[model samples]
Target: MNRARHHRRARAFPLAMLLAACAVAPPVSARVQPADAPADATKASVASEIRAGVSGKLKDFYGPRGYWPLWVEKDAIGPQADALLALIASVDVDGLAPRDYDPRGLQRLIEEADASPTPKALARADLALSKAFAALVADMRRPARGIGMRYLDPEVEPRDPDPSGLLRAAAVTPSLTDYIQTAGWMSPFYMRLRTARADYRARWGDLPGITVPEGVKLRPGGNTPEIALLRHRLGLAQGAAYDRALAARVRAFQSDHGLAADGIAGGQTISALNRGPAYYDQQLALNMERARLLPGPWVRHVVVDAASARLWYYSKGALDGTMKVVAGARESQTPMMAGMIRYATLNPYWNIPPDLVQSRVAPKILKGASLKGMHYEALADWSANPAPLAQSEVDWGSVAAGRSEVRVRQLPGGDNAMGRVKFMFPNDLGIYLHDTPSRDLFAKPARHFSNGCVRLEDAQRLGRWFFGKQPVADGSAPEQHQPLPQPVPVYLTYLTAVPTAQGVQFLPDVYGRDGD
Candidate 1:
């Protein structure tokens, strides 16, 4: 595929509209209730509650909207809102918002946003809500087991959800169960079902051996067609029956696709395999919600779809340069929100976080030797790591009493892990995009591999885009701190569906998040 083709397609407003979601819904004021001020106050209260319940489950069930008119009498969904709510809430969630009103507004807004242009003028807001209700209802009821994050029953993989499919399916299928599974060949949905819940080992079999086809053995010593296919994806060597190469490829694919790439095919990979094709459409829907929350003219900025594990840049409607990224690791998952670049560090100091160094990194160090290619720092005193934790020096028995502190930096060059440079973006969280020595990870369809911080595709290119005009000598700072000559913006938003050159691209929702 011509990278430019996709680059151009992604730049296309309609295409980008598919797999991206920016949470741009305007916050409603307490006073400005909809025109239909509580026709049946009690019923309105119940309906609002149901809407909230449903939106709480399916992260981006509704697309994007300024407001929803679910309260309008026209929707058939009014009667069965509870049913839809149950189905959506069936999906797993890593965390949930405690607030009640948030989900209600969010679900309605998503439905309203994805509604047809015809939907906007309809006399029935209930019809729109009902449509959303129906679609999600069908998603959970599918006869086939889901094969992505969690496996479902056997069945037909829905055809790729195109623009029109989104409309028709929107009225029928709801949870995107069919979208992630059957949508094949240049299908973006392959990326959407990637998720690693806590229990892959116990529930499902080994992860690497998973295959839709029959006769594939997952044992490390066996080389089967399934293994070869997986190996090919990972850029590993193919050895007739038992290709050692397939292990890495399977691991990478599993990692990228949000499977537990233990070189085994467990329940998670199966669920990822069988997800609905419209997952990308869902991504588009989700991103549209996110976009409504963004400041427009998103020029000269990086977009990291945490859901898809893909990064994008829009400079005059084009990617700054092509460099795929490895996002947050499953445990240190990336968040769903927006942030922008402020400054970057070239050969910058690595300030390891306290909690991570203590709990995760230090233990690995205590293993006494590096595992595989991982690196760590050693210090006689525990004070070296510069994070503001309450204590220091881990006491094996009272690990809690130990302070979360460890100073470690992977040096620049080949083994630097972070590669030659990093791009710094500002958010309440200490997250940013940077180049990684692990370029190999990018080839996988799903890429969740980092400690919360986003690993960008191209460091130099991102630097130029963010601070290209700024000047530098000793690298204190770029002189060109002024805004871009044309003032560009980068939007790092979450999305499941995004339009592509061929059609819409559905991606995996790596973070098993529920709610829109």
Candidate 2:
């Protein structure tokens, strides 16, 4: 993507666009009221009740406007009211409960006010609509339970939306429809999830429940009475004998559900098939909450979804490309975080983490293993320019016993753990994306084998995307720092429930972060 174009789009919509209007209009008193305006006594009564009824943000919002109704005009609900009510009704698409907003109650209030436009009735309806709008905006912005904070790293803090400012903007915007739809209130990624949720609900909301009996293992090229039931469960054609085609379908299902894709309808696979619509519905809701922690679509960034072991490059508010990735193993689970990739290190040395050195390398070295053949060396310190230390000078027994510690690093070569390059984000957690010599892991369906760092399937491809060309090393140097033209943001997130063409794919919670 063009740098200038990216910057232009990035600055096009500021966060305040949803909170505050671009140009403040004249005060409510400066504008003339409609011919059907209520009597002064009734208006005073309504304003007094509004002031008494609302507190906090709503009170502040309406106080400045003389308690005037934003959704009610000329004793009738305006188009803005209809639009807002419609949005509230469809809050389910955003993984929000419509009941929480009381859309039906709001609708009933509107109907009553329309039937008899009294001051008390109109005031009640107007206040209800404003409260509903505020609640919806709040939930969309920050979400309940801190936007899935339990599933995220402690470093990631979700930002809260300003309800008063949003309400003020909604009042002044020329077209409430456009403001609600295109004013950048919700993140584009969140909107995408909304669409996916709607699609999944439309397709699989009423999916039939089918349960193949437990303790029954059906493999391909086998004839059994349960084959027909299995086919029915998988949405395949009825067949008494499990054939190649059925097996292929079974494999696809197994892969999607995070099971071993051996094309066998084993107990686990059968259990997954029996996981009805309710499971997916809850999964989608959980993932939608998780999406709140992601960077907005306007920014140029790379997203690593730890759940699916995938990496996506997003530029110009759209996905540029994607590739397979290997995330942290269950034991050393990858944390959800956001950072900027400021530079890349070519011919990077795999600085073995201290913990790994204590657990793996120290034991081997104590067993008389040679570090030179492994391209490993001990560093005197972890400073920018630390001197190398001879292996003979180090006490391996104390290191393995956790009584002492030393810094160890692997030299840049074919046998190096870090293949050729490493993208540096520089966080306290010491997590970064790097090329790995172990490429076979990428081909696996479940690729969480790292120790809390992300391993790129094709570091050269990512380098080309990041630097417009693959960075190279002169072989004379190791840990060559190549600064990027501009820093690109990287967001590491987890989404156990991923949207797919057929329906939502519920990946296994490898780290058990999803509370499943």
Best by lDDT: 2
TM-score of 2: 0.64
The parts of candidate 2 lying over 4 Å away from their true place are 1-87, 95-138, 146-156, 162-212, 217-266, 273-276, 363-369, 400-403, 467-475
Evaluate residue 104 in candidate 1 and report its C-alpha lDDT on the 0 to 100 scale: 56
Show model 1 residue runs off by greater than 4 Å: 1-284, 294-298, 317-322, 364-414, 469-488, 514-516
- Candidate 2's residue-wise lDDT over 82-134, tens digit each? 77766777776776798898877887887777676655676788898888888
Evaluate all candidate structures by whole-model CA lDDT and list the values in order: 0.42, 0.74
Cα RMSDs of all predictions? 18.3, 10.4
Q: Highest TM-score: give the candidate number.
A: 2
Q: Which window of 10 residues has the lowest lDDT sum in candidate 2? A: 1-10
lDDT of 1 by residue, 154-234 (tens): 111233233323333433333222322321111122122212221222222233332344334464677566655545333
